[model samples]
Target: EAGVAQSPRYKIIEKRQSVAFWCNPISGHATLYWYQQILGQGPKLLIQFQNNGVVDDSQLPKDRFSAERLKGVDSTLKIQPAKLEDSAVYLCASSLATGWAIYFGEGSWLTVV
Candidate 1:
């Protein structure tokens, strides 16, 4: 089976700019997640989608970050007015269901100057 796929593998922008990333999860997976991994830190959950419904987004910085999984197939994550601290690797992951074995994408790297 194919693993999760992410696009725009690298991006660079000035502070306060906007950027977006896309993800396509493994086939047959029912759960999708977006995570942020800052340098030297573990991945932090940003948002989670169970099918086309949002499951959790408490950790997402809604002020500037937003995500959606429409049709329960693909997802997109966007950060408007991006901040310097937002520079990191955005990871996309998927699983058969909650608590099931998860697979991850290569990640979209972001750099905010």
Candidate 2:
């Protein structure tokens, strides 16, 4: 009945600085995701987690980004040496299954200047 929860509703960092985002998915959900949305664009899947393991991270930019799920409930995403182009909204989403409609959190707005 509840939705996904994300913290630090907004973040501002200079280019090359680091930032982190946290997310807690809805209870009993089996899949979680991290997405990046540039203004006027659809959210791009950064990583996918099924339970406590990674399901897909092919789209993630590993050179500057990392993510992890803890015990299949909580997750965190980090970006080091962030770039100006990293300014965007970071979304956390969850679904009951792989193909289910995902419920998204209010999103973490990042500003890299």
Best by lDDT: 1
Shift in Å, residue 21, candidate 1: 0.3
Q: Write the per-residue lDDT of candidate 1 for residues 1-113, one digit (tens) a residue.
A: 78899999999999999999999999999999999999999999999999999999999999999999889999999999999999999999999999999999999999999
How many residue-pair clashes does candidate 1 contain? 0
lDDT of 2 by residue, 11-113 (tens): 9999999999999999999999999999999999999999989999999999999999978999999999999999999999999889998999999999999
Which candidate gets the maximum TM-score versus the true structure? 1
Instruction: Give the alpha-carbon lDDT of every model.
Output: 0.97, 0.96
Model 2 residue pairs with clashes: none
Q: Point out where model 1 deviates above 4 Å.
A: none
Off by over 4 Å in 2: none
Clash totals for all candidate models: 0, 0
TM-score of each: 0.98, 0.97
RMSD of 1: 0.5
Error of 2 at 10 (Å): 0.6
